[model samples]
Target chain A: MLNIAVIEDDKYYRKDIAGHLSRFGKVDEGKSLSDAITLFDARKYDIVFIDLNLSGKMEGLDVIKEAVKRKIPPIVITGYTSEKLVSRAYQLGCKHYYNKLDIQNSFEEQMAPFLRSLVYKQEDDIFSNSFVTRNNILIKNIKLVTEQMFLKNNKVFITGEKGVGKTTIAKFIHKFSTGSMDSFIHVDIPTLENNMIEPLLFGYKKGAFAGASDDFKGLIKQADKGTLFLDEISSLPPSLQKKIIKVVEDKQFYPLGSDQLIKSDFRFITSTNENVEGLIESERLRPDFYFMAKDVELIIPPLRERVEDVRPLVDHYINKSGTSLLVSNDSLKLLENYRWHDNVRELKKLIHSFCNCNTEMISLINLPEHVIENTIPSGQSTPLASVYTKGISNFIKKHGLKKLIETIEIESFKEFYEKNHFHYMNTLEELHISRTAGYRIKANIKKLDKERHLVH
Target chain B: MFTDKEKLLHDLNGNIVRLGSIFNILNKIENSKDQEISKNEMNQMLEDAEQTAILLNNDIKTFISINMNN
Candidate 1:
């Protein structure tokens, strides 16, 4: 039987709802907010019907908000209704709002569908899609897309910070979507060589280039009757944007250096870590191309916004690391507070490193030095240093180790100078450089400062 | 003088509970034995509605304030 909570102050109305609801399941009645909260803490309930106004106050709506925070959607029943109140209730994750006075017959007239859903516990709905997340917002968004857009083979665009699991969600959609076997094709645009992107996307004819050998089948054709996931789509060259738009529009494209067009039927899903709107405005991503898959855009929120997911993610990573260790609450708190610039991937790496150390129990001491040092105090942000470090790491990785020391020296010199009240001696001491080298560093800083000013 | 999410929520919840009482009074008037509402009863209903509106507005503002500060 379904477990239900009813929070209504009116004795007669509470009895009316409870009497009807009792026929289907156990009903717990709460005449006040405190009683409702106490009942909520005792155990989980399948559903909650919260009166929007209780006694002479709006405590019932507050109870509804609390239920939503616990990932339980509550049906709001109010004696009076206003647009703002209804909208707010929905925003708090309520699925149904009933004006108590609108009932023509018994409460069952308005509640039959909800009761049936609870009784059957159907798995066919979007909520059953196993995307491996506890975030209600993300779950709701995924459910909406799967229910409304997936079956129609509509193009989907997933965007979020790098390593925020956009590609995983795409794979999940592909797995559940009806399609041909071995049809999930993923093309990493950033990894594709600039000179060979076209040939990789569209097959090249023999002798198309000086070193061309045999004919090559492009990814589009290979993904026929299946899903093609274009990852980091924002990195795709502008020259190819129109061609991609054309392919999406017509489902047909000619191989490189060929006169005949080849038709291929495939579903398209694209993901990007870059700001697509900015890219479109700058003419980097074609407007038509962007709009082709814009109907079902899913933005996976950054980890920091969904902090509740952090503990489960950490547990998942630890379990995957194959280390039999329990993460302390303190360590989890530290991990949660640290800005996840690299998102889930970074958290996994941290857990993997801890496993490498073979620790029986992971605590605050096991956290990475940078993460520990950069953990922002509650309500205060100290982000610049860590963000700068991440930027420098990416720059070094992309540009090779050449001029590494000089880059570090210049950055450190500037950082210390700016942060230390422009103390020349302090900056020099921090860098372990003499006056001659210091003059060169100062010149470099001035040059960098002038370049930054000009760019702005 | 109230501060923090829990306190603010508590304050709003109290106001809404009071507002619910006003709604209950209006409901009683609407379902009274007489088929038609008297002018005095209608005026009382209107007054109750006004009070409910003020309380609801205060509750909404409190929620907005909490969101902004957070």
Candidate 2:
């Protein structure tokens, strides 16, 4: 069972929280900040519940700040109606927030499932048992590259297909490197339109713009000494890209309407689904920025490559939703075979919807038709016989056929080789191999060509 | 089962609550004194409230012994 701590000044509210949370796990109660701290030091609690207003010497914010400093996951339970305080609680890494007034009505529904999922219990000590040098979560080579980027004092360029967890990997880098229990400021470039980009990145001084009453510190300054993760970096306008390059290179930037230059020392971790080489070739992304970023680059593979992770992902979602659900082998196969164009994010949403809508048991009949339909090749398209004639015809005459066949397993190699008939690029496209894999195959072919020459 | 120490702790917590009520009342009087009463009287009341709040917090904390039961 998970161990939890509840800190609230109100006696009734504190007892109510303990009663509700006890249904899921063991909960210890503390009526003040001092009591809470003493209890925290005594044992390892999975989650902590903190109230924003307390009657004692210490305020609730003090408790939250202390919890954050101690690297504890805090859930803010407040009675205050101020939006500013609620937003600040979230900014300080309070995963869940609830109002005290509504505790009687919404306490169990909100806190129970959240408490269950918040506890990061180890299924087993895989990290210690496993020979892998990296953390347990980052098992793939692509994740290792991202972790290396975090260790090095350099900007990283993360490229992957959309929904392929590029941003998730970036967040992992941020969490590992900073060692601070603070939220990573995620900025999507496309979300900030051309007119808002400058103000969003660089704070505006008081009266800098019309109707400006107070000085504003932009996301960059706020994320100082932490990570400023720029998602969709390729979508940033040319002007902003130039400014970003300067700031990233120099670690100094002037705020809007400020004559004095401000320096912010923040790590820049950028991710884009666009092809970096293609972007540079089209003159959309700056070559100099690309070169600077090339030193630490991580290319996240699409979900199809890591089919082994699918079952775990499904289990993760089921556990996340706190629901008892099962997926049949056929349904699992359908999920695995389908082209996950949207990636993990889409899969998570689908699972969440299923858990919320469906009852206890989720079988093949209950599963969505689209999920099964999209997965089967025959369901959506004509049969393979009608599409293309399948036969081995003149293998030697086919250009690059031998090289393409060598890259793949011998069993399926001949089938795809004959299907594409000599066109290496078409084979790569049909098989959904990334451009990097294709280039590697091309390099191997060149090496083979030299060896053949020497033999002749 | 309530031990002698737990009983003492509960009584101390009750006293702290009583002291907090007194402090809140004095604070209100002090706030109103600035408009109607003299400056010296307001200052004296404010000091009394602050001292009372600190003493109550300290005494109650000592009575409870945060790690007593745990």
Question: Which residue pairs of candidate 2 clash?
Answer: none
Across A13-33, the per-residue lDDT of candidate 2 in tens digits comes to: 465456566655457888788
lDDT of 1 by residue, A1-456 (tens): 456788988654565566567655557899888998898887577789888767767787789878987776698876555566778788878888886654324456778767867654632343344435778888778756654444356788899998788887887666545322338889999998898888989887899886679888889999887778889987889879788888977999999878889988877889889888788888878888888877698999988767877898888777777778788988888788876767877777777777887888878776655575446555654543443545667656754565455556675676677777788988788768898999987887678556543522
Candidate 1 wrongly placed segments (more than 4 Å): A1-131, A179-182, A378-456, B1-70
Q: Model 2, A103: alpha-carbon shift in Å?
A: 55
Model 1's CAPRI class?
incorrect
The global C-alpha lDDT for each of the candidates, from Candidate 1 onward, is 0.73, 0.65
Model 2, runs deviating above 4 Å: A1-143, A376-456, B1-70
DockQ-based CAPRI category assigned to the predicted complex of candidate 2? incorrect
Question: TM-scores across all candidates?
Answer: 0.50, 0.48
